[model samples]
Target chain A: MPKDSALPSRNGAASPGKEPRTARGRETLRRLLDAAAAEFGERGFHEASISGITRRAGTALGSFYTYFDSKDSIFSALVTHMSQSVAAAAAAAVAPGSTGVRREREALAGFLAFARQHKELYRIIDEAEFADPDAYRAHYMGTAKRIAARFDESVAAGTMSPGDNEVRAWAAMGMNVFLGLRFGVWGEEREPDDVAAEAERLLRDGLGPRG
Target chain B: MPKDSALPSRNGAASPGKEPRTARGRETLRRLLDAAAAEFGERGFHEASISGITRRAGTALGSFYTYFDSKDSIFSALVTHMSQSVAAAAAAAVAPGSTGVRREREALAGFLAFARQHKELYRIIDEAEFADPDAYRAHYMGTAKRIAARFDESVAAGTMSPGDNEVRAWAAMGMNVFLGLRFGVWGEEREPDDVAAEAERLLRDGLGPRG
Candidate 1:
């Protein structure tokens, strides 16, 4: 996927003044998003303030308004940005020609590593369920769709059995999510590669003993 | 397992006035929980009120105080109660002699059915992650433990391949949860049995094509 394509589509017509025009404007937008992640991740949506985000970013209050109209719009964008980051992480981890279950294992390992580093990812995305339900639904739906697409490729390559790839994709996404929750955010006692390998075993051969 | 043993243990010494001793008191408690479900489910934790719950229960203020001391306590108790309810639903669905993946499939089917009937379950439980962090973690941890125990049973009965059952159990629980979220809460175009069967196929076998 192209870098920008991974992120959620914004409505330029809805917010006319929000789009960044110059390279400096894009940098300012990035800074604001990082700062918003800290503010919202620490104080949550209700308590977090635009001033706090601006202060954390070391940007003027006007800079915040330059990119985001309100706290809600910024939050919605942050979620989309984070969702795209997760996809990008997984994409980076999978090498070219990585096939079937191996591809899934790599994606899960990448997610695990990302979650460990960005612990705030959980709180922010989870809060989106209540703060911005559309983003929350879109994040998971988009993720599952991506995984389903992989299943299609693997099936064409004769690397995986052609079953209900849609269901299988959702199941795989769920497995990665909870595994990340347990081993990634909660504790890093287990290695990401080890966790991913176990998951791959389950994905490839399931619970039954192999001959 | 004994009926009461399936539920989480409460510390009586922690809160003395909260427990009801009489049958009428128990009935009142049940009414309060059901009312709470509606109140919290519709309005969320912050906006939900004691009087709203009481009005929904058709009980007096005095009656509300008979079991729960405050809104937080009731929400905590409600989470535990709902967790128990989920376990009970699964227990009831599994047959006496069901083993291995069959047992898990039945449990998933039962959970799906319960989720469909009690749509508020997702909102209330997911809200607990923020509202009551301890209860939220406990719910998933306790659930994962039960699933791991089932894995132990299956292994001893020669019904399943023995690997890292702990990780396998969590993976399985994650699959069931997301499947429930998608098919159960988001849309019910698919049947519960069909979902469970597909899940069973994934669990018993895997993504690899059958020989």
Candidate 2:
């Protein structure tokens, strides 16, 4: 979950024998993925081209093939890469020993910040529904599972109520995603802290009128 | 909000001068939209063809032209049509005099059922992000506004706590959307009632431990 770990290698994302071995190679891989994010995020999957990604990365076509076999391969890798980056961002945001709703709030705030910085994240993941179905499903399924685990931990620590953690996790994830889209990606009129505060209040206290 | 009102006419969906006047014309327009839904849902906007929609609709190519100028027009119309259908479904689900969390629960349940029945709903709307950005923004913006209005009503009725209704609306919508995708479209392991029950619990009283 380290910030540096957000960058995926062959083991994490790249296809066979395409992994970057050195720090310089890793930098080049990061550049290509960032460029792919721009290319795919701007032009979408179909209209996006390998040459476009390379041009954006300022790398030669040979450098592109050194990392990815095709546009599809890099796209698939980029999705995975972004997913990891999201996880890293959230992990870095949460304070150690934080539990329950407080933990979720920090995570959400982190996500909003990430979304604002990487406005293309939503577009790429959404496009994956058509361009790469497995990656799309894997991203959500994986994130939901991690969230459910957090719920279990909170419950065991007596910091949170116990219920259907899986359902709650999905619900929580959905809230964060949409909040990111509206407040983070679409517009940044509201501060991340303000948005996360409202969300945290809802997560901690629900909509029922207080006594 | 009536179920029958889900169907869109020229004023509701079609381009200028394309509104169906005759009952049969209305029926043909309905068929074309339904067919467009399937065509776009399965093949996607880029790959979907007017002929494919007509073929699925069992209408002539000329019939397609009668109501729509081209595939783009129909896709835009279909987005509007589906948005209306979702609104109608939610409206029909809430019982008279319902308020607060209970009303939101019913709306989510209604949406879950609708998603189950129309598995293609998510695909078409998600595709609108790329195929039709205006329609996509309008759809979410409009839905969020409606949800916020419901929150205002609930607060006035003293059944729900006062907060940022806009934020709450977007969060509620995100929850319902993901729930639909997971339980309604992706799988049917859980009944709508059961899923809605859990979501209701979360919305009514969040993850905080009981006193």
Candidate 3:
């Protein structure tokens, strides 16, 4: 999986007019976001402090203000950053020419691995529901839209059966999210590939009885 | 669906030694929980206050202390109560002879209806992750266990194909959760049965290309 870009300028993660311009500045922004993830993940939004985030980043308090005006700004940015990171990870995992179930399998596998490494991902995103509802909604809505597009592509390619791609996308996204929660964050007994494979089978054949 | 019992004695929702004995006492306890749900659901854990809960319940402040030790205690009990309510809703929705995908469909449909009526259910339960971690874990773990058991029963009865029931259970639960979030809580544009039928089709046939 590709590393989450430290400079997600294209995604507008940084506050307007405060976007990092130089390599050094981008690195500083990245560190702050990473630190924000840790602070918020550990202490949650209400308890997390700007000082705590800057301390975790090992950057000066002024640097925190350089990129973000306040804790809420950084948190909203962090949610967007994480959402982009998840998308990048899944996209990078899909081999060129892969389609249909195979494409989704690789995506799920990639997400499982990402979730394992970033256990705080779930906590932070889940917290956004209360702290930053818009960002939370954007994350899921954007993800489901991407998944729906994949379904549309696969159907057009004659690789998968067609139905309500929108509903299917939501269902598939839900499946991946919970699988990651159970296998990736909660426990690591199951391999990502293994979990994805079983889930892929379910997606491909479902639970209908076989002859 | 059956009303969430005001006195969930079997589930041990009330703080120890505070379980309401008389019918009137049970009704008050029930009111307190419903009120707690609204308070926590609307204001969230951090912002929610004990006074707010009692005001919503229309009960005296002393009555709140009689059943619950503090706001935390009532929040914990509310999580369990909500979890039980969700279970009761799903169980009551299932027909006696239903099995396999049909049974799961009914369960999802039931939950969607319950969620729509109680939009705050998601907010309260999700907040439990931060406010009451044990209850959070208990809710998902318990729900997944029940779902896995249903899969096991269906497989044993030859109504469905056998696979990893535990993983399948989590996947199905995730699917139901997101669907409920989208259709139940966020919008009422889609009918519960209509959404369930689409999801049921996916569960029954999957995304495989049909001849």
Worst window of 10 by summed lDDT in candidate 3 chain A: A1-10
Q: Rank the candidates by DockQ, best first.
A: 2, 3, 1
Q: Who is ahead in lDDT, 1 or 3?
A: 3
Clashing pairs in 1: none
How do the residues A2-24 of candidate 1 rate in per-residue lDDT, one tens digit apiece? Answer: 24533333322113557776557
Candidate 2 displacement at residue A107 in angstroms: 0.2
* Interface RMSD (Å) of candidate 3: 0.6
lDDT of 3 at B195: 90
Clash number for each model:
0, 0, 0
Q: How would you order the candidates by lDDT, starting with the best? A: 2, 3, 1
Q: What is the TM-score of chain B in candidate 3?
A: 0.95
Which DockQ value does candidate 2 get?
Answer: 0.88
State candidate 3's DockQ: 0.86
Best by DockQ: 2
Q: What is the TM-score of chain B alone in each candidate?
A: 0.93, 0.95, 0.95
User: Model 3, which residues run further than 4 Å from truth?
Assistant: A1-11, B1-11
Native-contact fraction for each model? 0.68, 0.88, 0.85
For residue A63, model 1's alpha carbon misses the true position, in angstroms, by 1.2
